[model samples]
Target: MTPALSPAEVTINVVGALFAIPIVFGIFIKAPKLVVFGFIGILFCFSDSTWGQLETDANIYSRGVGMFYFSLLNLILMVAGVAALLKRLANPQGPQLAPPMAKYLAAFVFLLLGHVVVGLMQGIELDVILGYSGIFNVLNMMVFMYLVIMAFESEKDTQRLLLMIIALATLRAIFGAVRFFLFDGDTANPYRNFEGLDIKIFYFDINDNFVASLGAFCAAWLLTTPGVKLGWFKRGLLIAFLVLEVAAVALSFRRTSLIGLGLMFLFLFLRLPGTRKFMFSIVAAGLLAAVASVFYEHRLQFASEDDMLSSLIYDIAPSRGIKDGRFYELYAAAQSMDGNWLFGRGTWGTFSGDRERLSYHGDDFSFVHSGFGHVLLKTGIVGLLLFCGLLAAYVGFYMRHRNSLAGYARLLGDAGFAGFLFWVPTLLVGTPIIEFRTMMMLGLVLAMPFIAVGIRNYQVRAYQYDPRYAVA
Candidate 1:
């Protein structure tokens, strides 16, 4: 049975609500676009484990504090969304929605709802699926994306959003750097649990790497792009942030994140616009290499005394092959196809019948680690196809419309492409699908094409009326 909250807990809950409600109101009323940046910021900066640990440390272990925080955040978002909708209804001049993107988002939401029904039919407890399957999280992401598109129609708004991303990523990088020195012992093993200030904030080092790397990629985009004015101070800040982000990835000591970061830079190198921009890329590469060299010894020691670059090559080289949980997860997914191949198992369902059972709201199941395996196991072949189809559609759409994007939209599209490139390969070894940042990255890619087109059309109409006025 669930326990009731104590007096202290009740006061905490009430205070949380009071603080959250005003913030939500202010966001919707004063600056709706800020909501997008705030959501991404919180997700990148904090995680469920952080929340859980805080609750445990507070002597309130009946439930996690993270859940309450998340619920409050969600409530804030919902209230903001409702206010936006109502304002639009009351005033016809409100921001317009993208019909095509809306349809796609709606279809995705329907698929998620269908999966919930499938989970229920498979005898998975509704609460268990709700808690773990992440349906709400996915829905919230979709809504956030839609709202971003509506709220951020101008190039200035997009630039502000990107700046917000860079600032948060800088914070993450500094946090990681501090933790690297303070918690260096935990760097010996990638999988071991290490409690530190940074780990408590993000739950894992890979996340720190992921967030910072993407921010660096976007910053690189803005810095290298043609006609974007930047004073020396701003340019120095961007370069410094990029270098720090690269250093943070090295400090993560996670081979997958480092590999992902490398691949993202390669994509950026190729996607850069022209000779001048490519020249800038050369300089950026040199700076990053210099930063990596500064930490070479630490990274080498972290990776079993092998040089960091050499270790990367040796690990990913085909001769190393697949081991660890990757092989086990793939084998488990393949072996689970006997009885229920169509809808293999519900959320929290697993193939490991022999494994010891752990209780989650009175339900027990094993977890598939790989993203592909998770989809195949939880929703089966049909659901896997749907998920894959959505991804393919987004990729196809992005590729088709990539060249037409202008200004900040083009830069964002490049970042999205680089992110997708990095995330796709990591799925073989990790469950990128269940991750909030990965989904948000995909949301950006999915929404960017339409947002780009909208910006272009708006510019064209404005230019037709007044050619002397510049449009961005």
Candidate 2:
């Protein structure tokens, strides 16, 4: 029998249900903004269990209960998505259908389903296959994206979505900062060692880095982008939020995030109109100087034998290249893909041969450190091609349509494009593709360009129909 809940737990559950009922009703009513906000908020707030972590929960009765609830949330979103789609189809005046790039994404989803069939033919157990196939969560995110496109009625809806993301992301950054500075009641040496690895647990999940990076880029875009007219007070608040987000990324101590930040700036520099480029450069340099001064002050106060700055510098340095275990793991995964390079070893595939060193939790080799390597290991060159093709399609679509946008739409388009660029380094070096939270965040970023275009087109059409509907 399952254990009974305590009185406090019961009360908490009742309160949660009360709130959830109304939220579900709103979703059923085709509230796109509500659904998008709730979805993104949950992804930022919750952590998903990895396969290795699931192995450790074998003795717990409620081990997978969180995921069960998450599935129900996805189901609700899907039902509402279908309804929204039908409603739009029935009304010719509704928001336009999915953009052209969606077909490429659909093809990628089909390829993932084919991988599942291949997994079954390779004799992998159903449970193992389901557990290892992170692509399912990716599909869920895509559905949510479709719902976003369908349900958002105007450019204001997209603007509000961006605002909600910025607000939530800022809160997350603040929370992470508090945890890093005060969680252990230590002013210095705010890291804990698990086994031999020293990890600074800023938040409950590694995906917080994605949130911080996205928020930082968006804040910077709002603050620096030309034609994005903001009051001095709003600009001041954005500047403060941007600082917090940059600090949060640094405190998280993820090298991939630092690289992603650099790439984002590079993308912004190259994509911005020539007239705005100089302004952006000035703002970017000032922000960097501010962050450096803040960190330098903190380092001075917390300088110790085992200081945080030294550890961060050491981690960022390239001296640990060949000595890193992930390098060996990547090598092992590459060697395992020797014979099955065409279609891959399927979804539930594990690295073959002596992978004792690469194994997590002993004898488990289903997950790898490198996202590209993991894709190659499981789906082979063809799946890799499909994945790359989808990314390329988004880039092409964004470039082709970005010029048509103006004002806030254009600001969001540039920010979204830069945010997506930020993920490139993470996808190549980090295991984001297999991580549910990271993939959901990726889906959101991937949908932004399309959303921006939709907002632009909607406004253009509305203005064409009515003189009063002209964009401000």
Candidate 3:
């Protein structure tokens, strides 16, 4: 058995992310081509991998890298995007999504420099320059910002992105269903998980959380608007998708993601004004309660003697709450934190080169509970501060353009904010933050709605007011 990348998976990751580059660039500069690619990228994400699992130890099926993995595709896309950047030089004139944030972009650069300087002064080695992990994070951020820039190029481009996101969400839901019925939750094999590829194409591929997170993101988008494009077949698929995706989330047992998504939608339902939000909230809440009931019933049937949740519900049911059962795990993680409080060991991640010595999350682990924690582990307090500043810039810029798009813009903006805040549980979990797929997807989706703002302004000559800021 092979693992990770099937041929189609390779195409989706490579081609899909590559096209999203245009969506990013569109947010900054107008590029119709990016919209086409963005659709492709979104479609590719739906083509889950199957048949690439190889037996490592016991049930741990590991496979060689597949072509469709996001990281590998992004690398190829990066090269191509850069090459296209050359031709773009001729067009010289384009609109940017967040021109003012350029100031902050400068700030980010300065801060990175400062971190390096301080590290050197304090005799810290910057091996991140040579390490694949560090390099991946840096490049991933570039992809995030660039796609937002792509969307700013035009409103049509923004709409293109919206369509792509909606499509990806829909497809993911479909694939989730096909896999569930076809594989019977037997995600033990790659084919069982990814239904799009031949059973032979995929290697041990796992993207359960990736699917769930996006499912949440999509659900947020769909429920946010009135006329979200949903035909009966699509809507039915989405319904099925939601059920399977929610199941996947349960199966993943990704407590952090579930809690974060819950809080995010919670914020939206609470913060927004009017009946639409209110009614949607009621429906969503009721549906969620039902899902929770079923999930718990399932848990009861398969109750483990050593199950953590079971221990919490029964052993510490009265007073200890859920905290007592998992105190030791977190305490172990915190011990490492206290020792490396300041300049966290970024490269010294939980899922370092050693697979056997990893925590429950396995090889992909980063060991910092939250994304912020991951940042802390990587660059310490300094990195966290700089990273938050960059996010603030992203949020502020989106707010400025919110009115230019639909009500969905407001929802999308909140999603972006929530996505960032969503990492809080992870901070508590203190898991490794190297999950590259989530970052890329979050960047692309968040930027899509905001890029619409820039695109709208670009088309109607609204940007003409700022002659100096026009893409030159």
Please provide TM-scores, in order, for all candidate models, with all chains considered together.
0.76, 0.79, 0.64
Highest TM-score model number: 2
True-vs-predicted CA distance for residue 166, candidate 2, Å: 1.8
Q: Which stretches of candidate 2 lie over 4 Å from their true place?
A: 1-26, 47-70, 77-96, 121-123, 185-191, 195-201, 271-279, 286-325, 353-356, 359-362
Pull out the clashing pairs in model 2: none
**Candidate 1 lDDT:** 0.61
lDDT of each: 0.61, 0.65, 0.50
Local accuracy of candidate 1 as per-residue lDDT tens digits, 157-269: 66676677777877867766676666543332323433232331222434556777788888777677777899999999888887777766665555566667768777777
Stretches > 4 Å off in candidate 1: 1-7, 10-31, 47-70, 78-104, 118-123, 134-136, 178-203, 273-325, 353-366, 436-449
lDDT of 2 by residue, 1-472 (tens): 1245566765765566557655665664655667667677787765453331212322121322333433345445556666665666668685555566567557767877786676688776555565534445556556666666665556777778777778888887877677778774212222333232244445434567678878888877776666778999998998889888887766644456666776787777776779889888887777655554444343323333445455434433356574454466776777778689987777777775454654452666776776777777877888777677777877888889888888767767777787787788777766776665677677777777787888888788888999697776
Query: Count of backbone clashes for each model?
Result: 0, 0, 54
lDDT of 2: 0.65
**lDDT of model 1 at position 403:** 79
- RMSD in angstroms, candidate 2? 5.7
